[model samples]
Target: KFTITDGRIARIETDTSAGDAVRLGPALPGLANVQSHAFQGAMAGLAETRGDTGDTFWTWREVMYRFLERLDPDMAQAIAAMGQVEMLEGGFTRVGEFH
Candidate 1:
């Protein structure tokens, strides 16, 4: 465990002995969710249903753009908060929201 006091790291301790616990498992760094349209989480499965004759990235983008038109600052913040929460729950510590 480690504790930060004021502007510096103060105390550090370990529960087990030095060689008792070797690094065996994969060391996974926190994921950076780069390039996520924050508001799309709400609409993830919405377009998977029946749509026009052919549904492609362009078609999905059109739907996403329509959703974007409805969001203001507050809505955007709310969406970002929700997205961040979900990302953290899924082991992602940082997210790079792409507009």
Candidate 2:
């Protein structure tokens, strides 16, 4: 069993003990969501279609830079928080955020 508190696992018990009641459930390991540019989460599916010329990571970067030009600290934080929430809901316990 895995006991989580404050976004971390508090304890792991494989066998029941006498002092307290033991609860059994699937134990999930934390996962690091690597390779995420949190800023890109806001643009998911926005640039998937082929561009007039062509599109690739380079083109995507151009779009990303334009997006970053408008980001102040507060906007950045909000975007990061939203990304983290999405990662957590998607079963990621840790995030290796690139941006």
Candidate 3:
């Protein structure tokens, strides 16, 4: 059995009586995403190809800049929401969004 205090697990012990115990399904500890550029999620798969010379970080930044140029507040909000949903689905309970 487990006891929760202040939204956290405080104690765990073996219980002989199961009559009043609550049954919960499988559970796993959540993960934390320390750095997240959630707005960039909208650019997924948009700059994955190599250029004629070679693929470089500058080229990626250019692509990202172009995307940002056309992104409005509504689009940014949608992208951020999508990213947060993806994070939660991947077991991230805490996020430190950079943008």
Backbone Cα, N, C clashes tallied per candidate: 0, 0, 0
- Full-model lDDT, candidate 3: 0.85
Q: TM-scores, in order shown?
A: 0.65, 0.69, 0.73
Determine the backbone clash count of candidate 3: 0
Model 3 worst lDDT run, 10 consecutive residues: 12-21
Off by over 4 Å in 1: 1-27
C-alpha lDDT of residue 19 in model 3: 65
Model 1 residue pairs with clashes: none
Model 1 misses residue 51 by how many Å? 1.7
**Cα RMSD for candidates in order:** 5.4, 3.5, 4.0
Model 1 clash tally, residue pairs: 0
- Tens digit of per-residue lDDT, candidate 2, span 1-99: 556689778887788554554556565677788877877888777677877787788998888788889889999999999988988888887778775
Q: In model 1, which range of ten residues has the least summed lDDT?
A: 18-27
lDDT of each candidate versus the true structure: 0.75, 0.79, 0.85
lDDT of 1 by residue, 1-99 (tens): 444468343765677455544544554557788886767887788687768778888988898888788889898888889988989889787788887
**lDDT against true structure, model 2:** 0.79
Candidate 2 regions with alpha-carbon error over 4 angstroms: 1-26
lDDT of 3 by residue, 17-92 (tens): 6667688866567899999898888898898777667768988998999999998989888998999999998889
Best by lDDT: 3
